[model samples]
Target chain A: MRKAYSSLESLRGLCGLRICLAGSRPFKREVNSVKSRAKRLGLNSLTFPRRMYLFAAPALALFLVFWVFPLIQMFFYSFTNFNGINFNYDFVGLKNFVNIFKDGTLGNSIRNTLVYTIVMVGASNLLGLAIALALNSNIRLKTLFRTCCYIPALFSAIVVGFIWSYVYMPRSGLLVSLITLVGGDASKLNILGNHKVALYGIALVEVWKGFGSTMIIYLAGLQTLDENLLEAARIDGCNEWQLMRLVKLPLISATITINVILSAIGGLKAFDYAFIMTSGGPGKATNTLMFNVYRIAFNEQLMGKASALSVISFFCIIIVTVLMLYVMNKREVEL
Target chain B: MRKFRLKPQSVLLHAFLLCFCVLIIYPLLIVLSSSLRPPGNMDSPLLLFNQFSFASYIRAFEKMQYPKALLNSILTSGASVLVIVLFSSMAAYPVSRIKSKTSRFLYYFFIAGLIVPSQMVVVPVAQMIGRLSIPNNRFTPMIMFITCSLPFSTFLYAGFMKSVPVEIEESAYIDGAGLWTRFAWFVLPLLKPATVSVAITQGMWIWNDYFYPMIFVTRRDQFSIPVVMLQFLGDRENPAQWNILFAACVLCALPLIAVFAVMQKQFVTGIAAGAVKG
Candidate 1:
C-alpha cells in the first residue's frame, strides 16, 4: 500500500510539471500572436484599442452621467420656464433669451462684465509680469516677496471680500484713515461708493487676488527661456530693457497667452468679490453677468431667464476660449 | 566704463512692488487687528494701537457657534477631499492606462467639466437634490462638492499618471496581481505627489466654498464656516459690529492660511507642474 501511494504521488508530480510546461508554451505562443498582430496594426490598432476602451469605461461612464447629462439639462432648462420648485414648467421658447436682451439690468451687467474683464485681466497680467521680471533679476528677498504676494491668492474670495469691505469702510477703514492722516477728507472718499470707481475698485481687488497666479506662470515661462540668447544680446550692448522687450517677451509668449485666456475667463465669471462686497450694488455699478445670473435665479426667482443668461455666458466663454486658442496657436513659436 | 548708477526705472520698479505688497498685506493686517480689538473700541480710527483684546473672539465664537461650525467644516472638507481623491484617482487611472480613441474622448469629456461654471449647474443640481429627496444636510453638500471637484482632480491625476512608466504595472500583472491590486499597491503610491496636489487644491476649495453649502444645505447645523460667516454678516438688524465679524473671519481663514503657508512651495510647484503638463 505504501509503495502504491509513492508511485501515485510521483505520477501526480510529473503530471503537474507537464501541465505547467504546456501552459507556458501556450502563453508564450499567445504573447507572440499578440505582438505580431500589434505589429501588423499600428499602435492604436483595433484589438489593442478594444482593451483600452474596456479599461477606460469607468471614467467615460462618470463623465456621461455627471458632466454631459447636467450640461444637456442646463440647455433644456434654459428653453423652458422652469422656476426650479416645480420641474414641469412650460417651454417658453425664446422668451427667456428675449427677456435678457431687453432687460436693462442684463445689458448693464454685460457691460459691467466686459469692463471688469478688461481691467482685471489687463492689470493683473501686466503687474504679474512686472513682479516676475523683478524676481527674475538680482532682487533681494525674492522668496519672501513671492510668499507675501502669493498669500492673498490662497484666501477664499469671501474672506478677501470681507477683509476689503472693512478696509474700505467709510468711517474707520484703513484707506479712510490713511487719507485722513494725509489731511484729506476721508469721509467723502468711500472707494466702493462712487459708481464710476466702484467697478474699478472691485477690479483692483480681483487683480490683487489673482496676480500671484499669473506671476507664477510667467516665472515658469521665464525659466524655460534660453540664457544664451540673453547673453548674446548683452554682448551686443543691448541694455536690460531691450533684452526684455526683444528676447524675454517673445520667448514667454505661450505663458502670456495662457495667462490672458485664464484671466479673461475668470473676469467674465467674476462673482464672489463683487457679490459679497457690493452685492452688485451702488447702482449696480459692479454687477457682472454672472452676478446678475445669481441674483435673477436665487433672489428674483427668474429661473428661466437666469438659465438663459448662463447659456449666453457659456457661449461667450466658448467663443473667447476658441479665439484665444486660435490666436495662441497662430503665434506659437517652434522652439 | 562708467560707474553703475541707480536708474530711476529700478527705483520706480521697487516702489511699485512695495506698493503692491502693501496693498496685498493691508487688508489682512486690518482683519487680524480688528479681530483682536475689543468690540466697544472697534469704531476707533486707529486700529493698530487700539487696546488689543480677545473679547471679540469670544463673542464671535459664541454668536456664530464657531466651535460647531469649525468642526462641521473640518469634517465636511475632510470627507469631501477623501471622496474626490479616491474616486477621481480610480477613475483617472484607467483612463490614463488606456490608449483607445474612446479613452481619449472620455479624457476630453472629463476636462470639459472644467469650463462649465459651477453656477451654471446650480439650479439643476439644486432641483435634482430636492427631487431625489436627498437630505438637505452636510452630507448632501459633500456629495455635490465631490462631484464638482472631481473634474479638476481627475484631470490632474490623469496628467500625472501619464508620466508613470508602464513597466512597473506590467511586472505586477505578470506576477499574478489583478488590476485592483496593481493599482492599490503600485499606481497609488506612484501617484503621491499628484494626489497631494489634488488633495490640497480640492481640500482648500471644498473647505472655502460658500455657494454650494449656501444653495444645498438649508439647516443651520449643516452650515460650513463660509455660510455661517455670511449669516453672521446678514444678522444686521442691529448696527453690525465689525470686530466680531472680523474675529469670525480670522478664525475661518486661519486654518487654511496656516496650511497653505507651510505647503506653499509644494502647492506652487504642483500647480505649475500640472499646468505645464496639461
Candidate 2:
C-alpha cells in the first residue's frame, strides 16, 4: 500500500511532466484538427452591411431583454420593499437604503471585503511578478512550471474554496498536520475558526489560485516587449532590478492595470469562497458584500434590501474602476 | 561564446519556482487523497494516497446524479458558446468593417457592459426569472449566458477583426460572390481564431459560472454541476460526508482540467486578450 501510494504521488505530480514532455511536439496537429473541423462548416456566409445587422440583432435583443431589462427592473425594485413572493410591493422611500447603515452585519462585511480585495490583489500581483520574472530567465522545464502554476485559475472559484477549506481544516487538515510534524502545538490554532484569521486565510487561497493567471498575463506582456529596448538597457549597465524597474515595469503598465481592476472587482464582489468555505461565519468575519446580497435575498428573504445592496455595489465597482483607470493611466509610460 | 550553463543563480531561481509550483499543486492533490480514503475518521490529513478506495466516488456519483449534471453543464456551456461565437462574430463584423459613427458607438456601448457587473441584476433577474415560464430546461441559463457573454465576445471579435485585411472581402465582393457566400466563405474562415477565442472564453465562463444557474435553475434534478455539487456541501446528512464532498469536487473539476490541458495555448492567449478589457 505504501509503495502504491508513493507511486501515485510520483505519477500525479508527473501529470504536468508528461504534458510538458508532449507540449512542444503536438502543436501543428491540434491546429490542423481545429482547421479541418471549421473548414467543413461554411453555412450561410453573409457579407452585406444589412446582413451584418440582421446577424447581430438576435444577440442584441437577448442583451436588451436579459441584461438591460434586468438592470432597470432591479433599480426600481430597490426603491420598494418587495418580497420575492408578491405581486404587490409598497414603495418605502429610502427605507431600504436607510436600513443599510443600521444593519449589524453590513459594516463588517464591507471591511472584510476590502481586506480580502487589498490583500489578495497585492499578494497575487507580487507573487505573479516574481514567478513571471523567474520563468523569463533561463529556466529549464518552463512549460511544466507554468502549467502547474496556472492549474488553479482554470478551476471554478467554488472548487478552489472547497479544496482550501480542506487544507485549512483543523486536526486532520494539511496545515495542522504539517505544523504538528514540525514540533509546534499548532493543533489548537484554528485559522478558519478565529474570526480575525478566517478572512485572511481565505485571502491566501485566493492569492494561490489567482496569482498564476496574473503571471500568465505578465509573461504575455513580457514576450511582446521590444527586445531592442531591453538590449539597449542592458548595454547601459542597468542590472536586473534596475532594468525591471525602468523598462519592464513601465512596459507592462497596461497589463498591470488590467490585473489590478480585475482583481479589485473580483475581490470586491467575492462570493464563492466565503459562501463555500466559511459562509461568512465566525461572527461575520468573512462575509463579503456580495455574500450578504445572497443572505439578504435568499436566507433573510429581504428582496428589496438585496436589490439596494446590488445597486450600491454596482456603483462601487464603477467608481473603483474609473479611479483605477485614471491612476494607472497617469503612471503609464508609453514607449 | 559562453556555453549555456546552469549557474548558481539559475539554480536558486529554479528552486524557488519549483517550490511555488508545488505549493500551488499540492492542495488539489490532498483533496484527491481525502476523496479516495475510506469513509471513516478523517485521519492522516497529509495522507498521500494510503488506504485509497473508490467508495466515496461511487457514493458521490450516485447521490449527485453525476452523469446528468455533467450532461446538463456540457449542454448549457456548449449551446452558450455556439450562440456567442456565431452571433458575436457577426455582430463584430459590421462594427469592425463599417467604421461608421454608429458602429464605433456600438463598440463602446458593448464595452460599457464590462463596468456593469452582473451582481446588480441578480436580484431582479432572479425575481424576473421567477416569473418567466421557460421550461426547466437549460435554455434559461443558456440565454442568460449568451446575453452576458456577448459584450465581451463582441469586444474581442471586433479587436481581432480589425487586424484582418479588408482587401480579401472587397475582392470577393468584386468577384461576384454573394454577400452570404463572401461572409460564410471569405470572412468566417478569417475570423476562425477569434471564433476559437470567443468559444473558449465563453465556454469556460458558462461552464464554471455558478451564480446564473443557481438563480435560474429551480429544479434539483435539472441543476448544473456547480449547483448540484453544492448540494453535497449544504444541509445534507448531518454527519457531513466530506469524503463524498471531496469526491464531488474532483469530479466537478475534472472536465475543466481536461479542457485546459488539451487547449492550454489558445485558452491562455484568449483569456489574456480578454483580460485587457477588464
Candidate 3:
C-alpha cells in the first residue's frame, strides 16, 4: 500500500512538471509567434478572446452546474443512503447496490428493460431497412409516402403514448373494433392490461413510432452506396435477394450499428411512454429501469437507491455502446 | 412477353410495401376518424363510418384550454430555438476560427454534453432552480430548453462553420470589418441552412418535450401543450374523455406535422447532411 501511494505521488509530480513546462518560456515564444500571425491575418491573439469566452460562459456554466455537477453528485449519492429530503446520510459502502441485487422489482425492471431494448431495436431497424428498401424502388409519390410515414416520429412521446392509449382502450378502441369486425374475440385483447403481452405491446408501439426516423437514416446510407456494385452483381446473375444481402447490407453496416445503438439507448432511458401509458403497468409488467428510478425517487422518495439504479443503467448503456463500437470497428477493419 | 418474369416479383414487392404503408397509416387514420366521431357515438362498434361531428373538438378546446397552451408552447419553443441558435453560433465561431489546442479541447468538452442523459440531472437541476428562487414559470423551462439544446447546436454550427471557406471571412477582415460585423454579416448568413435545420430539429424536440415542463411548471396556465394533454389524460377528476383527448392530440400534433410535410425535402436532406458531416 505504501509503494502504491508513492507511485501515485510520483505520477502527480510528473503531471505538475508537465504543467510547469506548459507555462515556461518556450510556450511564451510560441504564443508570441501565433499572436504576430494573428495580427497579420487581422485575427485575435492565440489566447481566446475574453469577450468570446464571456459569451460562451452561460452555456459552459449551465452545463457544469446543471449537467456535470448533478451527475457527479448522483454518483456520490449512489454510494450513500441520502433520501430525498435532509441530504444527510452515511456512506454504507455498497449496501444500496447489494440491496438492488436482491431486489426482485429491480431484477424484473432490468429484464423488462433488456427485453424492450432488444425487441424495439431489432424490430425498428428491421422494419426501417425494409421500408427503406421498398421506398428505394421506383415508386411514384415516394416523397409523400416518406413524409407521411415519418410524421409519427415528430410527435412527442407523451402525445404518442396518449394516442396509443386511446387506440388500445378496451371498450371502443379502433383496434378492438377492428378485431371484432374480423370475428376475433376483442374482449380478451386488452393489450395494456395483460401481463404477458403488455411489455411486447409497449415495444410494438415504440417500434411503430420510431421506425420512420431509422428508415430515413437507412435511406441516407442507401444513397451513399455505389450503383455500380448493384449493377455488377446483377450482371453476374445474382438474384435480388442475393444482391442485397451481399452488396447493400455490407455497405450500410455502419448505419445499422448506429441505428441499433440509438434505439437501445432510447429504450433504456424510456420513461414518458411508460409513465403515460401503463405507469409501469399491472404488476410491473412494463416497468423499465428509468420508470422504476422515477417511481423510487419521486413517488417513494428513495433518492439514493434511485441514483444507484440510474448509475447501473448508465453503465449498462456504456457497455452496449462499447459493444456497438467494437462491432463497427471490427467490420471496418475486416473490410 | 420477353421481360414478363420481373413483373411478378415487382408486383409482390409493391404488395408488401402497400400493406406496410397501410399498417403504418392505420393508427393515425384511427385517431383522425375517432376525433371526428360524435361524442355520444364513440362507444358504437361501427363508428368508423359514422357521421362526423366537431363536438369533441369544441369540448377538447374548452376543457384543455388548448389555445393558451399552444401559445405557451410556441413562445417557449420559438424563444429557445432563437436563443440556442444565436448563442451556439456565436460560441461556435471562435471555436471553429481558432486552431489552438485549447479551443479544440473546449469543442470536445461541448460535444461530450450530448452523451450525458438530461434525465439523470433532473433532481439536482430542479433543486437548484428551486434554491435559486426562480419561480416555476414558462421562462424557467425555456431556459432549460436552451441550455440542453446548446451543445448539439454548437457542435453542428462548428462543423458547418469549418466547411465555410475562411476566404470569405478573410475578405471581410481585409475590408476592415470588425469581428462582430464579420460574424453577423458574413458567417451568419452563410449558416442559414444549418440554422434552419437546427431550428427544426431542436424546435420539434422542445415543443414536444413533456418531462421538463411537467416537472418545472406548476401552474396550469403555464403548462405547455404536451403537458396539458398528458394532464388531461392522467387527471382523475375528469378521466380523459377519449374522444376529446384524441381531438386535442390531433390539434397539438397538426402544426409540427404541417411543418414537416411542407419541409420534407429540406428536413430529410438536412438530417442526412448532418449525419454524414458528424
Provide all candidates' interface root-mean-square deviations: 2.9, 2.2, 2.8
For candidate 2, list the clashing residue pairs, or say none: A45-B180, A45-B184, A46-B180, A47-B179
C-alpha lDDT of residue A163 in model 3:
73
Q: For residues A1-335, what per-residue lDDT tens digits would candidate 1 score against the true structure?
A: 99999999999999999998889988999998996787567655421233434444554554555556667788888898888677679999999999888867667887898899999988999989989998887665678778778888777778788777766777667788888888888788788888988999999889988898788878878888888989999999998889999888888887888788778878888889778899888988988888888888889887888889988888877787788779887886667
TM-score of chain A in every predicted structure: 0.83, 0.83, 0.81
Interface RMSD score of candidate 2? 2.2
Candidate 1 lDDT, tens digit per residue, B169-270? 888877877777777899889999888888876787788889888887788876878888886656322234777888888888888888877888887776
Per-residue C-alpha lDDT of model 3 across residues A133-244, encoded as one tens digit per residue: 8888776567767876787888888778877886787766768888888888888678889999899988988998889888998999888888898899899999989988
lDDT of 2 by residue, A1-335 (tens): 99999999999879978897688657777877765665466332334444566656777777777788888888788899997668689999888888986876566777887889999999999888888888887778999999998888878777777777767877667788888988898768789899989999989988988898888888887878888999999999999999999899999898898888778877887777888888888888888888888888889888888888877877777787788889989998776
Q: What's the residue-level lDDT of A36 in candidate 3?
A: 82
Cα lDDT over the full model 1: 0.79
Residue B95 accuracy (lDDT) in model 3: 83
Give the CA lDDT, 0 to 100, for residue B23 in model 2. Answer: 80
Score residue A310 of candidate 1 by CA lDDT: 89
- DockQ sort, best first: 3, 2, 1
DockQ by candidate, in order: 0.34, 0.38, 0.40
With candidate 3 superimposed using the best TM-score fit, by how many Å does residue B102's alpha carbon deviate from the native? 3.1
Model 1, residue A91: distance off in Å is 2.2
Stretch of 10 with least lDDT, candidate 3 chain A: A45-54
